[model samples]
Target: MNGHALELGGIEKRFGKQTILKGIDIEARPGEFIALVGPSGCGKSTLLRIVAGLESPDAGRIRSGDRELGELPAAKRDVAMVFQSYALYPHLTAAQNIAVPLVMRRLSGWQRLPLIGRWLTPRATRDEIHARVRQVAEQLEIAHLLDRKPAKMSGGQRQRVALARAMVRDPRVFLMDEPLSNLDANLRVHTRSEIVALQRRTGVTTLYVTHDQAEALSMADRVAVMIQGCLLQLDTPQRIYQDPRHLEVARFIGTPRINQLDARVDDEGVAWVDGTALARCAEPPRDRKVVLAIRPPALHLVAEHHPRGLTAWVKRCEYLGTECLLHLELESDATPLIASLTPELGTAYRPDQRVWVAAEPSQTLIFARSGERLTAAEPRLERSANQPEKLDV
Candidate 1:
């Protein structure tokens, strides 16, 4: 079955005095994999529940293709949700679990009983259900485990059973709410690739919810970042990382977190950090304070006393074999800064060692006092007389 496009308009959810979602809007093209990601309590899961018809929105509407799903119960939405808990029955075998949807949907009430139901059910209908279950099991490579109950299966195997159950329906849309969260780290990584491949092969319109930013960035065609009940940005992984529209979006998408420094725009339209002029703002706020955000990779360690460089004392270092992260305390403003370096280069620095940090202006992000990103009309950097030459380390 082909996937259907999903559209969510003006989606709002509230619980008494608290609002969980605030007028969210999103559209997924047919067969697209969209990841909804945010920190805990950010309402990403609530939004996914709304899409699955498991939770009702106080306002807004959900549509799949031309059909509006606002009034449909969870069973009638033509959507299949693979929940985080696997939700497998302990007594049911894998094949039985996978066949539940079909059995419930296709069988009469009398045909659902134990021994009598099997005889009462049509021979053709029973064969079709069994054949479909086997097909799903084979596709998931779990045919051997069909006889094993969930109690005997591993987490990943049980997760596959959950997926197989969802796949058996061949629903128009797939909703996964942290389906891999229960897996161990290595298994989670392996299953991530498997899930992406499965989605591509099935071509199902999928909405995956997770609190892991890395998972969202690595697996999804597009990612929606929500925070405090608001959808902050929705775009490809590259754009979400490189061209975030808001300060909160910038702060949430990257590892080690983006560095924030207090900065100001001078009367001459130049942005300065710790008395060092870094770049020219497109629309400078005269003598107004602002926040400058720089990604860890964009900040390079330079030799001590480099011109226009900010002096920092290394407070700690974390070596991750492939690379090293230096935690620094800037002397000028006492702001914490982190710089990622190749292991070879990072090993040369030790705690309490003083160094200089410089940011590539083009990669730097400027935010207004209100926490909105400032767009540069022109390139942010202006060739400065004291600008340090590119460093090797």
Candidate 2:
């Protein structure tokens, strides 16, 4: 926890009888970017609001550095939020909107008057406010568009202005909820890179929420995957994709997603589908149903059919410019299998053509019927030497 700038411990949120978030925990270090990602109804946005103080949790604690911000208002928490909508004033120019935060903080309580505020402005305070606004606008690269209103600017420009407003306050942390959502695909990619660069430049801890796994995978220092109001797994993008804790995380984090296949385990811990045994298998209950997952990229089409793998028939071919995605249907179970390759059509097989799909034993992942992941481990015995516990027991 020493390195963490924002910590949400055992956070639970509910509305009457409905639970939106259930015992969620997240940690973001100083100058670190964290992405909260889940499906549309999985409460990712609600959790962000809790961190922003826009929504209060039913139970649990949220802390920043050494201070516990359990119930602090948004203004008092020294945290800034940029919403997806940007929420800018249509009448105020970008510079005016950016300057509003500085004005509120620097001006005297009575000097906030629109017309007479100029008269009461202390010269030093006015200069400080203007300097701060100009500095943030320049940092955000919106100095050229400062005189334009929200309607007159592009979507990306408006987002920059909103960020400038947030940054003008020099907040310790930033809370962004789908800030790139409103932009088009190309612009979204550009803005995502900009936001990541800005976070690094400002050195502000940020908590971002989005349903896009690609966005989370590409930009976040750590990605937290939530499902049904519970945090499923939190790890780096590579770990979340390669070493998922369970079957659901494996399916949700990838682009085309990993294939989850039904399998049967024999009495000797060997996995089988229609009497064909797979090698290097993890041990599960004898004669129990299990799940075998192989990512699309891990499987290959073989010329000779063997007893080790299942036989599949090509159902459809989809060309996605970079690769040809072949949808293969298993002959025995009729399960759909997907294989992607770099536009290499070896035989020009038509639909319903038989193809032998094979994957190495190390590439396959096995999960129990209960959705618990199985990892290969060697059996070792350990005695509690210090505790004096008997190994026989």
Q: Give the Å error, residue 33, model 1.
A: 0.4
As for candidate 1, its clashing pairs are none
CA-lDDT, candidates in order: 0.88, 0.81
lDDT tens digits, residues 1-393, model 1? 498999999999999999999999999999999999999999999998998888999999999988998899998988988999999988899999999999999999999999999889999999999999999899889999999999999999999999999999778899999999999999999999999999999999999999999999999999999999999999999999999888999999989899988777765566677657665567776447677889998899876665557888999999999889999998865789999899998888999988999987787788787777886545444446663433111
Q: After superposition, how far is residue 261 of candidate 2 from its true place, in Å?
A: 0.3
- Report the C-alpha lDDT of model 2 over 224-285, residue by residue, as the tens digit: 99998999899999888888887878888887778767776544455566445553344664
Model 2 misplaced stretches (Cα beyond 4 Å): 1-4, 279-287, 345-347, 377-393
Top candidate by lDDT: 1
Query: lDDT of candidate 2 vs native?
Result: 0.81
